[model samples]
Target: MSTLLATGFSAVAADSSSPQELIAKGEYLAIAADCGACHTSPKGGAAMSGGYGIQSPLGTIFASNITPSKVAGIGNYTEQDFARAVRQGINKQGQYLYPAMPYTSYSRITDSDIQALYAYFMHGVAAVDVKAPQTHLPFPFNIRSSMALWNTLFSNNKPFIAEESVSPQVNRGNYLVNALAHCDTCHTPRNALMGQDDSKALSGGSLGSWYAPNITPDKTSGIGSWSGEDLARYLKTGHLAGKAQAAGPMAEAVEHSLQHLSSADIEAMVAYLKQIPAVNTGGSQSRDSYGAASSTEQQMRGDQASAEPGWAVFSGSCANCHQANGEGTSYYPSLFHNSATGADNPTNLVSAILNGVHRNVNGQQVDMPVFGPDANFSMQLTDRQIADVSNYVLTTFGNPKVSVTAAQVQQIREGGPKPLLAQLTTPAVMIGIAAVVLLAAILLGVWVSNRRKKNVARK
Candidate 1:
């Protein structure tokens, strides 16, 4: 398939010569949107035949089947229905979708791209009869109607409007970053109500146990020190050799989305990202500042040597790949000065220890063995053991201030906290707030009526 990088936008030919061409175009758009990351089941399921369980504060919301199966998927949806659902967060049945689907960002996608995505899902993709497990969000979150208010508050249900002032490349980059990539959804901090805190866009946020670090061009906490090529390399390969490496949600993104995008598109994203305002998060050292390790083979092997609990675990299980000194080989990442290890928050390190890293770059798999019992890794680190190792890693090789507790490790091991506000906003609370407002209005109306009656009597 021929990909055109015309006028700074990475797009397929407008006049697709055949159905194959159109399907190809649609496939590219689907890659840009990264539908497969959330839509496809992680357990080797069919494409777009959603069965993946998305962990949120409310509960586990399963990704819905989007394939064009007559009975179980989006076969019934019209182009308008699909477009509306993709852009407005409303389904064909008029049900509101949670922000977990990234509709808030998808809302900014262009009509042409949405049409392409629709074509890909409805035609190019294979249909599966299997139905995804229904999402059962707890309490007020389950009340899908309540999302109407949320949409009104947060969702920008408008198509991309190119900035006349910026260069074509910047506008293209803006469109890709703000709309297709949905970078803000992960990187930007959320408010009390879980809306993206756009004021600090791309300045870092916590995705439960994983921390999405600041991508803004700030010299300290953000990517200010990084060149456009640095950003591009990180996106394309999920690693930047010595500077940074992707793990957690970022690794999944690279594996599923950015790696598939064209070089022009990645460059455009980097361009747009570099132009964003820099935000400082108080750290003085550069992102890759954790000191390198010296040889610890002898220390680790010594029977009489006193090692920390985590060090003992690392020596036994992790040292083979990561090395006794903590400086890993080309395949296994170095612990010192690594992004996963040196992060301000210890979530990603804990998550990496539990979930493990496995991303394919340029046909080579960069794999890490999971330490958690369930995820099919060789080693099963207990909660206490994981905590001990996590704390040791943070203290010795990464940020010493960031320490993990056994309870924290256990919570992350069991899929982190469900969205706190979602759980807190119960049905009773919403009803109570509504009732109070209604009662106040009624009392005001009654008082006004009595006042009007008195005035009439006086007349």
Candidate 2:
């Protein structure tokens, strides 16, 4: 697959001579897209056997097993069945997959790539016969048919077309970002319908507990401060020393997907990302250009530990790995000049505190100890205590503007606010409701008519 550097992927994928080449290409494509991040269960199931429960506003939407199993997976799926499922969000059984699968972004996958993917799924990977737990979204959301209308309105069905104006490399990068990598699934803000708001594309999107920061090259609010190398390093390794570190979903992405891409593909992605239009999400300072090292660890040493809740927690729990100055070692990323802490939203910062950094990549475990209860390593911090420590870190080593509330910490802990899309004026929900109502009325009319006939017959 390293031969990808030798020729254009679009061309190479199409001209691959043997089944092995096609399978290899598909494997590489799957890595770039991070398919396993969603399909593979974090709770230790067979690879791609899919018991992974994705937390959405409505309920936990479980990912279906995509193994090539005859009974439990997609072994029976033809190429067309696989294509429809991947691009159009329709299953082999003609069911609508929830948008959590990112088929909208995958909709741009070229036919050749889709074929490669299909082949790989069928041949390259070992099949597991485990069935995924069925998703039981409450009420109207459970009506998967409504998604057809949603798709009609929101999803772009056309495949990606390489713009003649852009360089071939940039075009390749665009394909990866929009189609395969599905960056917009997290980075782009959603509309009221929970669809990607293209107007604010790559500006920043909410992941309930964590916020995906703006990546549109804005000097203040986004990654405009990062050089190409810095961005590439951050993407590949999930850290940039003094700049930023990945946690939550982004951490998983680096561990599973981005780190596995070839050097050529990485460059292509950066090249495309560099030229995208800058969008401002209303931050006055660069996320990576905030705060300084504090000597709180020193200040709190001996019996002089300040009673301030945040400082006390930081001095006691955080000062060990992060150091007294907040500079941190190579393994432990510094708290200051960090993107998560410096962002306008404290969600990411709070999230990291609540759910500590955990990623295993390149044969090493990069773990920040968890503070939450049940798994409360050394620190069994409460929600209020976590909030205080969050505020303390923000004020001392991160942004001074933003602060976390105990309620907010609790909300993040419990998957944030549930924005009921059905509660809105969405036509899709209304139509489903109307149809149900109409059916009920028809049934009532039939019952009344039958009762009248019964009386007549009795007479």
TM-score of each: 0.88, 0.90
Candidate 2 wrong stretches, greater than 4 Å: 1-12, 300-306, 420-459
TM-score of model 1 (CA atoms):
0.88
Candidate 1, which segments miss by more than 4 Å at Cα?
1-12, 15-19, 303-305, 375-378, 417-419, 425-459
| RMSD (Å) of each candidate, 1 decimal | 4.4, 4.9
Q: Write the per-residue lDDT of candidate 1 for residues 1-459, one digit (tens) a residue.
A: 244322323353464666656667778777788889999988688989998988876778899999999788999999999998988889999999888899888888877777767877888888999999999876657899999999999997989999998888888888888888888899998888898889999899878767889999988788887888889999999998666778878888999888878878888898899898998887767656765785554465675356667777877778889877788888888888787777677778888888888887778888887888765444788989999988777777777767889999888776666454754656677788789999999999999999999999999
What is the alpha-carbon RMSD of candidate 2 to the true structure?
4.9
lDDT tens per residue, model 2, 47-124: 778888898776799998899999899999999999999999999999999999999999999898998888889997
Give residue 212's lDDT in candidate 2 (0 to 100). Answer: 88
Lowest lDDT 10-residue stretch of candidate 2: 4-13
TM-score of 2: 0.90
